[model samples]
Target: MDFARTATWATAIKNLNPDNDLSVPLSDFLRRGQHFAEFCAFSLRESSLCDFLGEACKCAAAACNAPMAKVLQLGKSANRLTVIAQWGMGHDVVGSDAGLAEEGNPPGQALVEGTPVVVPDLSEWPDARVPELLRRFDVTTSINLPLIGRSGPFGILEVDYPQAYQVGPVEISFLAAVASVAAEGIELMSQREALTVQRDLKEVLLREQQHRIRNNFQSIANLLSINAVKTKDDAARRGFQSVERRVFALASMYDHLLGLHEQRDEVDLSRYLGSLCDDLQQFYALKEQGISLHCNRRLGMTVDLNTCTTVGTVVNELVANAIEHAFPDGVGRIEVALTSNREGSVEICVGDNGRGTRVEQCNGTGLQTARQLVTHVGGTLTLQSDPGKGALWTISLPSKGHSAA
Candidate 1:
């Protein structure tokens, strides 16, 4: 019942050498290796294939009681196998390549035969092409396990010991099991990296598309401005100017969307509403009439992009309407306020200290457009007015459209 005490006994059983082990079940030892490999694979989800291999080699070398461990991956060229990760080697083997046809290479043989190759003694081996290299490193024993995944054999895991030790069936089986898990982990990691690259590329293309759309809108607005200035009739000129303001408003929407940088289905309304008010004040030429626009955003919130655009367009139309009709005497102030209540609903108030107009008499195209936008955003619009006093237009938007960032 006491797992901790049992684990302590397991830890105290220190002679991991299979040749000396006589008490613990061999399955227990192999189970520990399997658990260790699973832990490594599970914890390394975000790491690169090389990092995974490096850590794997370290663990494998310790378990096999080997002095060195190396993992080679198949390169783009079919016959080339490149050393990607290694542990405990006196010299670096990373980036070194081995040809498939190289004679007496156990790794190449394992890859070809789809099985493990064990050399219990390298010094006495007569068929080894690189026995001198092994002798130079003081390596006397080696085991190469083919890392075969669902796609087939993709690489080899080679471990080297300093002494000429007899290779046992238990060690071979354990190493083969490790190689199997390593192959699957490498395959999953590779797929994840590829998907990340694709997602990044998609974001870049979307940003470019937004930039192009904004530029196109700006060009159209410029053309409208040119035509408005050249027109002889006052009515035609005013109409052109109105169209130009709408175009610029649409362009500002794209500007904010692009500024977000990442793919987002929601928009920050406080920043968006403030920017919309600034743009409308300039577009309506209110400063020339000694009129000032003040914006008060008390709460920060985000809504879907569609709702943001609707809210922005409504604000643009309402503010423009006030500058043109409310302040007929040509000198006054417009205050824009955005606030949220305890119920999580937002209220946007646009008020002007100018001659007031009745809500029923507000039959202008801009007011009608604002009403439609408000309805689409699932909000209500209320107008308060007195003949000599200022007028205030309030839009109450529910919190349903908000996105929880």
Candidate 2:
């Protein structure tokens, strides 16, 4: 039969036998009902563990026809079981504590034996804890089903009726199946909490690493600056200056990457490239040289750290080349524009209003470095230089170049 027809039959049989008999047909019906209850338990998006447990307690009580039900969670003390959720026994008996494994208590017996503990009549029961607990609440029959979780028995599902009733093995099994679903919920919650803790710890470690690496880069830059000042050879001094500029470029990347530490290795190219241009303008002293550096942001995109770094390095080389050679008279305007082309590729354009070079004349170390860096990011570089008018360098970045190999 279809699920709807089977479900209807199961509900009718469940209503007929509130005590839940052990007959084959009844067992199958109860099993189907337990499966449905379990499906609901896992699907519930309750606000808290207490809310989830409360729903679970209600489902158990309704399925067993019991007047009262309680969900007891293993307490922090390990030896104490505290009532976290309840049904029927109103007025909120939550925080009620009972021994975890006391020989006489029903909950304790279930925990100790790793199975269900059923008491047909608490009045004649030898367990003093169970009798006292039931008498105070005017309860007679009780069943405690252990919630066996990954960390052993972590809780108990208790169902109680006002008068005496017989509980067979089949009935106990049905309750145990429901308890397993609750146990899974608790286990899932624990795992989520652990993952959250691990994620938080990883973020902390990443921030620390970023800070340490920045300090080390600064130390190296300081040492290089000192050596460059002491160098007597003109060529050696210029070499030192070039190395310092490259080091500063790397350091700039580190500073920006540190700002995005929470984002892992991803970078917002718009912000990152804008910051790099600002640093370059300051480093090259373009303003003092009567040069205007304009940064135009036309696209907002994010790429992996490797792509950002390579792109940043290329920009640094090309912009620095323009500052040194494009404006030999120390007077010109350089424009850097970032945008996406018609083909959805990121386009980086750096141009200067000064004398430009031919395509075949791209033999300098800076141009060579820029060309190599652009290729590394799976991009193409085009240099256009005309005498007296200007020089324009365009780097077309690939659409899928954001991912690292």
Candidate 3:
């Protein structure tokens, strides 16, 4: 593991001279290549920054036949380098700081020059702080390789040899390649950390906005309810109640939207429609009138928020219309069923077992509004009615993005 002897042989092999022996240098070159490959694999497997740096130092030390190696990262001010990772002969120097501007600081000099600084014989150096510092660990030679990033040099890879050693071009080339790979890995890890922070902040802000919107909708509905109770005219009271119900419907949509954290653009159709029906039944006091409202979902499906809202409004209007005019004796059953077909379309059928009316003669504003909404979203509405068998309204919508045709 004598770096100087092996480096001389490696240099001879690089010249491609046929007189010199190449067996030993070629074997050493292959061994160094294998170590470089192992370092790259280790870098990819590690996720934590600290662990990656520590293992990188170990790999560098082993590859260069050096007894010790450490990584020094530049601080925010760009004037100081802090020891972040060490492989061997380290007496707890991980948090130690070295001033970059300090005279004879090898790492600082390497980073400032944007290249490698080789100290062939630290023992013969005169009045230098870095050489004096290395004397404590019995080091006579060292090399500092700058870790260059996108902006510029950001850190240093320092390898310390126990003897006076001259690093040849082949060894320096191998170490420089390792430094490049390590710097790129560090940069990628930093970017991923930043993106994760931004995503978490965005979710917090979105949740706060959802809460405020839900509260505002509830307040509006409550005001409408209070005005309906105070109004003396029967028609005016009914109008207020109808407006209040529509406002509450919008509020319910927001509630569902808030619950869907992962799929914000889509809603659970079965759960949303089922909740809307329950709210309408309670609002109309259907149970006291011997009326039961039932929602039957034949299959689970999800649709975008816009389509779900439109479908909910149409169902609300149709159901309310049945409650008001279908059951004259105040005793009947209403059923809402959701189904999808092989044609990539969804169907909602609202049927009641009360008195029926002719489809051609029906001309209520609610029914008209429902039909218009359905048509606006590239969907269709149909009504089937008889004298005594009850009435059935069917709405068909595209399962995916529905827009005006």
Candidate 4:
């Protein structure tokens, strides 16, 4: 049988046993399903908007049988619809009208003074501005759709082809449908924005909050830095540096949160993890010493910004503990892995062959604080060691989705 057939058979085997056996395959397969569901449900909302726009563009392109087509979202506050996504286009034309809006600019003629204008031929346009733009970008024939939405004129969908192509009636209808979808998406966006706000408030009660969390993290780091400097001992200074790194990790999560709009609930965890790892490696030199990342490229899920940041900080702390305590002589290996189970729990493991968790050596306050923070987020940390083998720090992030209820 093929791979799909094989998978189907394997799934049948699992379904046959609802007893929840201790087999690794049974557990892993179930976990993978949960993660997959989360992935589909929690992906980019803007892409849904972007997809609608792109489909409209594709339809319009096919109707005209045009070689090149593009769609731009006219900024509500700005005068132009910026190029959001595109398909088959001219050489000089790439990024030429990227953000070109109507403000009495050269290409501004295409926007029809912020109004939608359609031209059969660019070189033979009645408007001087249209012909001038054609000359600037070289010979071109294009149709511009003033993407009208529920609010007002949103943007322009420009479909272009060489001199011979013609924009037909079928294309025009499809173009109109594309415009309608874009409008509908923008209208629902305001509604979704309200829903997102309510969702965030439910996650953490704070009014008038628009990413002030980032500032809070920075402030904490500042305080730690000052305290570290006040102590003269090398060990005391090292202690503060440790706290500072954890604080920065939280700051990075806030950065991800601030990047999202009303619709986006998740950020690229691989990108997020790689960046945090880079910062840690630079300071502690994990790259120079043998460190590898085994994180899933598609490993991402949605949680409240506060929760993610908290997780990030904990990861930073545990990773630091492994690096500092794992390889005492500054030589060893470390691996970071992020995987989620089907039951909605996330398994984040950071391991090093240098040494076991030196918790007994860690001071009481730091360890206690770390433990409390993990508990708050519904997670637990496990420190594993083998006599001569390295150390393993396994962190389990509880599925906030089911539990948040």
The candidate maximizing TM-score is 1
lDDT of 4 by residue, 29-67 (tens): 454345333333333355565555555555556545566
Candidate 2: list runs displaced more than 4 Å: 1-35, 38-41, 44-48, 75-77, 87-95, 120-140, 161-170, 230-233, 255-267, 281-290, 302-305, 328-331, 355-362, 402-405
Q: Which ten residues in a row have the lowest lDDT in candidate 1?
A: 4-13
Q: Give the candidate number with the greatest lDDT.
A: 3
RMSD values, in order shown: 6.7, 6.4, 6.9, 20.0
Report the C-alpha displacement of residue 88, candidate 3, in angstroms.
5.9
Residue lDDT tens for model 1, 13-103? 2222455553547876876577566646654577777777777787667777777888887665577677788888743677766545243
Better of 2 and 4 by lDDT: 2
TM-score of 4: 0.42
lDDT of 3 by residue, 239-282 (tens): 99889877877776567656444255666788778888888788
The per-model lDDT (C-alpha) reads 0.73, 0.75, 0.76, 0.58
* Candidate 4 or 2, higher TM-score: 2
- As a TM-score, model 1 comes out at 0.85
For each candidate in turn, the TM-score is 0.85, 0.78, 0.76, 0.42
lDDT of 3: 0.76
Q: Tens-digit lDDT track for model 2 on 52-117? A: 777777777777667789888776566778888888877458877655576678878876765566
* Ranking of all candidate structures by their TM-score, best first: 1, 2, 3, 4
